[model samples]
Target: MGCCSDFLQRAKPYVAMISLQFGYAGMNIISKVSLNHGMSHYVLVVYRHAFATLSIAPFALYFERNVWPRITFSIFVQIFVLGLLGPVIDQNFYYAGLKFTSPTFSCAMSNILPAMTFVMAVICRMEKVDLKKIRCQAKVVGTLVTVAGAMLMTLYKGPIMEMVWTKHVQPHRSSVPETTDSSDKDWLKGSIFLVIATLAWAALFVLQAVTLKQYSAQLSLTTLICFMGTLQAIAVTLVMEHKPSVWKIGWDMNLLAAAYAGIVTSSIAYYVQGLVMQSRGPVFASAFSPLMMIIVAIMDSFILAEKIYLGGVLGAVLIVVGLYSVLWGKYKENKDIKESKVMALPLAITCSEGNGHNMDLENEDRRERKPMA
Candidate 1:
């Protein structure tokens, strides 16, 4: 029972992270369906978070009813900022990019998060630098490689690879048009949006790490983020979405997409992510993001009939390489720190014990040498 419990404790986070990716992959499929059916992304964001707020509110109120901390202006400001960074700015830009690109393309591009987060952490002085260490050098090289991969994906679109799913595919209206002018234009535009979104996501990872220190209730914190995200998205929706018709969600696929996005992606996902971050730290939680690329690629191949491009495949390979390189470097550095502490412990104990024994001897010698005692 003890061993089984230990195994479960270790396996829980990995399960949660993988499950999160599955939710994201489903969201991508449903979202593409809704977008193709003429639902505006802006309005979708508004509704997604609104339902997310509703779904999470009851749990937050119930679980944290008595244990809630005193809310301060600073904490409220932090949560508001988190809402803007994540669900508002990050998600809006992401959807805009996805509108102009395929799910696999967007997910592959987001593989830059690990490198992006490292650079941002250094800039913010949250992470220490040691250029002499090979670990630090690996991280720097990994960041450059990841960025290069992103650029390669944006600038190049080589021959399409034939896959088995191509035979069973049905054409979708939302797929990018096959033309030099339109494809190139939309690719660049969407890539820009995705890059900005990735940066916002990386910043959020760092900010959440800091904020969790101040506001320790993970569920309540995520609930506040969703609530504020709903309001912010609505504000954006009001400015950009002028058509009341676009906001009309009926008993069709739009409602299904919204329900999936709200209940599964936003509410459940946000809560699970909060729990994981509370346990594993930000990088550990965010490192699982690359898994979405594979999930999306496979799902889109079948569901969206998206063609696989040579450049995208190669870029994704490079990005995955760089992602894992940085993670390995971090792991090695942390391990070294632990091993160093372990090695020093015995030496420290030995030095103190020897000093104590010497003092005892010296005191006894002085007493023996005393003229009278």
Candidate 2:
């Protein structure tokens, strides 16, 4: 009974993370369907954040009312920028890209996020790199490999690989013309948009790390970011989409997409990921991202009858490999740091217990002693 309970405790984080990935996959597919049905990306962004803000606000108000810190000018500016990068820029561009391309492609391309974040961190001097260290070398190599995979996916759209279900399901053609030249151009454009969105997402993560120092109430911070993002997205939506009709959503996929993305992906995902990260660490949480890509690929083929290409398959493989390499390096680096700290404590205690002369003589004697055969 004890062993079974212990096993279940260990399995909880894995189960939660896997379920979270499935939720993300559902968001991508549903959002793609909504975009296909003439829902403007601009309007979608606004509504999504509005729902997110409403969902998160009550919890923030109730739980963080006592502990919430005073918002200063600098913190406000950071929060504003966070809102801009996340809701306004990231979601809009991501939705736009998904409109042009398939959900699987977008999800696969998003796996480059860690590589982009690493580069940005290096540029910001927030991360250190030592060529001599194998861990650093792995990270550098993995980033390069990830970039190569993205380039491959963008430049080469090899022959479409047919799936069993796709053979039976009629291809759901969109309003957009599928001429070879136009489709290729649209794919390139979508790839560029997805890349831009990923970069903004990475920047948001970096900025969020810095912002947390001043404002430590995470729920309140998330609520404020969502509220500010909602306002910003509304302004952008008004500017981009003049048609009031675009704002109208009923009991359909649009409403479902908005509600699911805002509530499940934005609010609940953040909370659940935080819980999992607390138990298994951030590496474990992020390690399952590629699983979402795979799930989306399968679901896209089955549901949307979307065509998959050989180049995309190959590229996704490379990205997954590179992602694991980077994660492994990070895990090793963290383990080494923890081990060093543990070793330092005992050494510090030993030095503190002995007089300086005695400690020095003991150290010399230990160094002078020969190993037994």
Candidate 3:
């Protein structure tokens, strides 16, 4: 029964992980479609945060009203930083990158997030190093390998034929002349931007882990940060775009997509992630995100009609393998620690009994040796 209960507990997180993966993949498709339909990424971010703020505000008020009075300046500062790193910087960089790179590449590049987070955590002293521990060594090496995979995926664009399996494909018969002379340059720029976005996301995970220790109310904290971030995003859009027309909201599929991203993806998915993080720790929660890349790759191929290259496949595999290697190392280290503790319990009890028995024998000997008492 205990084992069954433990299994169920573990299964809950895996289920949440699957949901997050699917949610993120759907977010990729919807965001791409929305972008193609002429929605500016900046304005779309504004709408997402605006709607997410509104959606979560009521719940935060209702559930956390009594605790609202406890919020302090320090907490507010933490939330401010959280908002900047998470919703503002991370979202802006991501959308900007998406504008330049294909969804598949964006998703594949995102798999580096865990590695990035590990590096950032190490830098921040949130994680400790033990060079003697193979588990720790594996984590460090796996993180490096994952970063290398990301770099390869970003910089190396091999022949298209390597990606496509079709034999004897007809050459392009287009009589129309190409217009752009700097298309490759633009693509490269976009890929670079997306890599920056992944780095920002990785940093956000590290910050969240630190902040969660101080602010235990994940929902309330998230709501406040998101609310503030909406205002920041709006200000940014206004300053950058500077046109009144950019703020115009249209009632179309694009609007629906924005709403889905806001309400479902931003609000719901974030809350679920926070809950999972609280239960399973940051690495366990984030290790599942790479699965989103697989889902995105499949969706892009069938739905968006994007091509899957061999390099992309290899990069994706490298990322996934590296991610699991880190997680496995952590898991084994934790298991060994627990086992060591369990084994030490018997030794501890034996030592205590031996000391007590020696004391008792000494007392008896002293009592028996006492002169005619």
Candidate 4:
């Protein structure tokens, strides 16, 4: 009974992880489609958080009805940091990067989050280091390899001949034009921005992990953070779009995209991720993002009619390989820890018995050697 209960508990997080991946995958496609339809990244972010704030409010109110703690200065500070790191800096940089780069590139860059999170966690002393252990070594090496893969994906276009061959066979090639000088420059700029976005995202992960330690209610904390983020995003948007004409909201695909991002991606996806984090921990929960990248790439090709170049495919493969390496290393490390514990239990029991036998022998010897009093 206990084993079955434990199995179920473990399985819950895996399910939540899958749900978060699906939500993010859908978010990528929807955001790209919305952007193509002329949604300014700023306005989209504002609406995304606004809707997320609204969606989470009812749940927060109900779930946290009677016993909600009064907001303390520390809690306020934590929420402020969450607003700054995640919703503000992270999302702003992400959308800016997306504007300059392809969704595929952005997705590929996201694979670096785990490594960045690991590094930041180590720096913050949240994670222990054991360089002698294969698990730690693998994690360190795998993270570096993943970063290398992201760099390769961003910087190297490979030979034009390979791109030409792949494009000739791919169905979406008909829609996409051969690279032009202007577009190439745009792509380069976008790639660089995406890398920056990835780094910012990594920072957000570290902040979130730390914040979670303080705020026990993920739902309420997320809701409050999103509310604060929405306000910050709106303020930024208003300043950036000083002209009233630019602030006009239209009921089109862009609006739909914003709604999707807010309701589905931000609110639902974040909620699911938080649930998963509770069970799986940050490392396992994050390992699923690369899978979302693959899903997004395929959906983008079919739905958004985007071209898949050979370079993109190679980059995707490298990212996956690197991500798996890190995950596998972590898994092996966990297994070793469990095995060590199991082995130590018997040794501990044997030592206890040996001590008991020694005490018994000493008592017998003392009794036998007693004076005839």
**Superposing all C-alpha atoms, what RMSD in Å does each candidate have to the true structure?**
3.3, 6.9, 4.2, 4.6
Better of 3 and 4 by lDDT: 3
* lDDT string, candidate 1, 160-200, tens digits: 87887687666556466577897889987988899899999
The candidate with the higher TM-score, 3 or 4, is: 3
TM-score for each candidate, following the candidate numbering? 0.84, 0.83, 0.83, 0.81
- The true-versus-predicted C-alpha distance at residue 303 of model 3, in Å, is 1.2
Candidates 2 and 4: which is better by lDDT? 2
lDDT of 2: 0.80
Task: Give the 10-residue window scoring lowest on summed lDDT in candidate 1.
Answer: 168-177
Candidate 4 lDDT by residue in tens digits, 1-373: 9999989975776677767777778777667767766677878888889989999889989997775666889879878877776677778777766766667777777777777778777888866679898777877777777767666765676654233334545555332224898877876776667667667666666666666666767788779888898999888888887766555667877777778888887777666776666544566666667777777767766665556656667777776777777777767866777899999999999999999999999999999999998
lDDT of each: 0.80, 0.80, 0.75, 0.73
Rank ordering of all candidates by TM-score, starting from the highest: 1, 3, 2, 4
Off by over 4 Å in 4: 1-5, 156-182, 333-373
| lDDT comparing candidate 1 with the true structure | 0.80
- Residue range with the least summed lDDT across 10 consecutive positions in model 2: 277-286
The true-versus-predicted C-alpha distance at residue 179 of model 1, in Å, is 2.4
Residues 1-373 of candidate 2 have per-residue lDDT tens digits of: 9999988976787688789889989999899889989999998888888888899889988998999899999999999998999898999999989899878778877777766677777777766789899988987887778767766765687999987777777787743346699898998899899999988877876777667768878888888888899899999888887887888999999999999999988777765665654444443455566667777877877776767778878877887787677767776886798799999999998878777778789889998896877
Q: Which candidate is the best by TM-score?
A: 1
Count of clashing residue pairs in every prediction: 0, 0, 0, 1
